[model samples]
Target: MKKLSALICIIAILPFSLKAQRTQKPPLHGKHWMAITGKPLAATAGAGIFQKGGNAVDAACAMLAATCTMWDVLSWGGETQALIYNPHTKKVIAINALGVAPSGATPEFFKNKGYNFPPEYGPLAAVTPGTPGGLCLMLARYGSLSLEEVLAPAMEMAAGYPIEAQTANSIERNKKRISQWPYSKKVFLVHQGEKREAPEAGEIFVQKDLLATLQKLVDTEQAALKAGKSREEAIMAACDRFYKGDIAAEIARGCQEQGGLITKEDLANWKPVIEEPLHINYRGIEVYKLQPWTQGPSMLQSLNILEQFDLKSMGYNSPEYIHTVYQAMNLAFADRDFYYGDPAFSPTIPVKGLLSKGYAKERAALIQPGKNLANAAPGNPYPYEDRQQPFQKLLDIREQWVENPGKDKPGSFVPKHDATYHSENKNEMGWATTKDLAVDSLYMDRLWRGTTSIEAADEEGWVVSVTPSGGWVPACIAGNTGVGMSQRMQSFVLDSILDPYNVVAPGKRPRVTLTPSMALKDGLPYLSFAVQGGDTQDQNLLQFFLNMVEFNMTVQQAAEAANFNSNQLWLSLGGTQVKDRQPRPGSLLLNRSTPDATRSSLEKMGYSLQFGDRTSGPINAIYLDRKHGSIWGGSSNNGEDYGIGW
Candidate 1:
């Protein structure tokens, strides 16, 4: 009778527990909130900002600063881009923080010299940097906190802290390149406030020059606003202080001296263009992404194609399921390579035709059952052929000089000599679709592309989403900032991803794979988001969309549950190449942080696993639940520490 009574009582409470778990309110104290990234402190810093009355935009800005200070592998002074949705305005917005080539740049210049326009890390590599300008724009337009308030934590942290394990690893790995830059040595190598080199993790690494730069922005803004400048005027003043004024001139002069293409004109003319985001409808949910400059649109294309199938019945992580998705990824990736590019620059690009529903159907027909469409002909290969002429010559010779990438050689930056990348597989096979392949069995994709940060705001009925990124890194490292700008040539990889036949010519903005995405359902804002990790961004995002809309998973569950990876990239060092019946590359599997039942289940489903620190990129999102009067914010704890506030 006692056991029966206890069982009855447990049954009575089941509904309540289910309800609580499903609809529990957020910002709950004592609940273990999680975030993933390369640095623990930075993730903590991002979450802390969210806890401190900062919204998503504020949290992102805070995280960006922390990343700059801590994750020296990539951070501030680098490029960023994002897509945001505002419920109030009923629209999505985009911010382009991508850099541009100098006015003096021309394809002929490189051809005449018998060399690539920008030698990797060459002085002529600097492009117009837009990170600071874009960050300020988001804050000034939407954030309630002052720049000083938002940047305060970074300022304090930058004052003292040792180099982290990740930073030390990146520095040591890239030591050869670091040695080439005097500024990098002055800031990162030498100990803070001491002449000796800082030791590995726990030794203080300070960016005094960066702090000084932040201080100038704050002081100048305060003075300008106190002088009765309008908010817009004051913001512009601050931006100019960073871009066109003394700061801009100094950067421009350094770039010029370094043999970079950026000039005073590039900086002066450079501005973050607020453009309308490209959007598509998938199963009644509206999806918005940045236009051709990045891979976001390609993701949408894959989702649209997949919408034609019933993924739920296929079951989670099954081989058939994974194969179907891989096929979609490969198809979209092929289109991205052949047709996507900057609309303003690549005349052959078919942005309108590619995204059309009619076109999506045509592309979908190419996926055959039970076999691979490996090395298939492009969807519309003609338009791209003319544009890709100059870069094709380089591709023919790439096999002779490009060294294959390997995990053991993670420290090896770019290939310097001819080596068979496809034959020499150094990376793990991304997904379980193919067996009998080891790391050296597959080719390498250049890891340098897609240095990005995403941000969004939903304030005062206004919305903004922006993504900032560029083609290459360390265009020049600033000693004071401890940051490197990107040297993005209007080149082949970015364009080829969108339009394979398109020739990579000079002065063209390559089809960007850096896409920021937003979603709306039932005439209301549903989510604001973006994906990072180069080719992996699109693949992960496609799964995310299916989980939420097709399978009816909650946003958090859809994003968090998977063992994620991508194979859409080229088999070459920088592109994705798919062999017949061979699996794609870049799998982002969600392994058990603490091994148990989940691990066993995932392994049974054929996951080739590796452990990564909590800070994974590829996500950060917030949802506005109007009925609940609360904002649902979460970050992917799988990698980077990402968060949502307000």
Candidate 2:
């Protein structure tokens, strides 16, 4: 009897022991490693480059190669904006590899047609893509690995690699779109043998054509270098093959034949935008991001507002801390909607002024305890377009008095506007789209489109953050390039809080919700963070940053921690905002993993909660242990194969 009881007890504890073993930190591996955007093959490919004595750029090249092999939806011929920070130089380089709008684009065209721009500005929105150009340029300037050495890993993977679940999902989601493009469909859907068939799990996938293209570049490099030319010159010579030489001619012909906007002049004129990276100081740590046209500054703005409160004392994910963070984020988003635009066009866009310390202090002072700020107004830095200017004009006209000053404001008269504009909008759409005017009017308005991507190069000790868009929908791919077309109009969505006015503007890069950032403390790399959730990127980044900085959580812990996110542009249930509540620290809504204690506290803070999923965005990151002198990178399993090369 005694033995039986002892055995049972041991069995019960055995499960506990097993659980502990499962949760233990992964055993250490040999150092000097690399991780890329999530995918096993990509990881292997990048590791191969690292092992081959290639630096991060080589690894990045390898990583991109793997992405081409494993995931076409988010990789390949796609634009890449990178911020490569050379730890050695202690300086960051921003690479704008995004495609540019056709010279044909102009904003007046849309208004003239009396048509809202299409979801994705299609043929009209095509831009000269710069992924290949930008990648080659970076290699020319700062890369230690030769083009062949860097591209070899990718070429191998493209020549053959295994397909994963994520790839399948992407194919299915965009099946119709993929099928529409001859090259995309040819490679993605129907190729056979060792050359093109989609691999089942554990099988190798390959891209013979892609490999051939890479090989040609390598051949160019060798020919140039053997002639006693500088390696940079050799690489540039190879790059010309893609931009100004045979490749450009072929691409130009493809676009012209397919009714796309690209011309040989566009390709030849294509030049990568190289600019100084934007940097900001947050809580004694200097953070960095790419400039406007992206929501990178939103993170800085949120951090600035967060610095006002004792967030750490409030605890990680607490309702109080989250509410404060949410409010700050909302304000920052308001500014993003109102002022963020392409600097070349919108000179009045106060990107610097908005990020100024004075602005942050003023915004942070608005937070009130115990209740929400009813009718909370977005920051009005650019009120010229909204109220002040219009109001002053009306006053100048000696307009008749109303019930109240507020009564005449748009928000106050929403009920009246809704009653009038809702029906009027439908009637106007009917008249505008009449057959007589449809094509001509639509053509009159220059449609704008956009694209966004992140790039990392270890050789340069940096990453580039960029969101370039404005011109069109990226649906039509010039067959020769095997790259998809961009219809930037899709960026204009009903989802943005500013939807009605969300039309794409001429020469405007469009207000992107992308917030790519690198966090550091005491001059050491702490995190490389980015998420993809449209406008939610900035909102989500705010919470994650707070979890790490204010809450002092480990990178993994901070990233994995449960939390809520608000689309400052969207609405919530219960006639209230979906908030990160108070009482319970570190509690948020988007994450169902949040503790019950945190939930209860948020409830007390007057928030109605909603559960969300980990698929919010593919959040990818790297954590550096300053004291230990090590770099640990991981991609969230929450969405797709995001942490592929980690």
Compose the digit string of candidate 1's lDDT tens values, residues 9-76.
Answer: 00011334545444222211111122222244554565565455666566566655665555433445
Mind giving the per-residue lDDT tens digits that candidate 2 earns over 1-646?
A: 1221221100011234435333112211113443545444555565666556667666665565555434433344445566666677776667666565554544455435443332232344455666677778877886677888877767767677656644543344344655655665566664333433443454565556566667777898899999998989998888888778776776677666766656777777767677666777887888777676566787888888878889888776666776777678767765665446455444555556667777688888887764444333445443333324222333323222211223111210001100111112212213211112121211111100012223333323444333322211223555655554544433332212232233344333444444567766776566667655445566666676676677665654455555566543321000111121001112224356566887676667755454543422345556665566555544443433232222
- After superposing all C-alphas onto the true structure, candidate 2 shows an RMSD in angstroms of 11.6
lDDT of 2: 0.52
* Candidate number achieving the greatest lDDT relative to the actual structure: 1
lDDT of 2 at 273: 74
| lDDT (Cα) of model 1 | 0.53
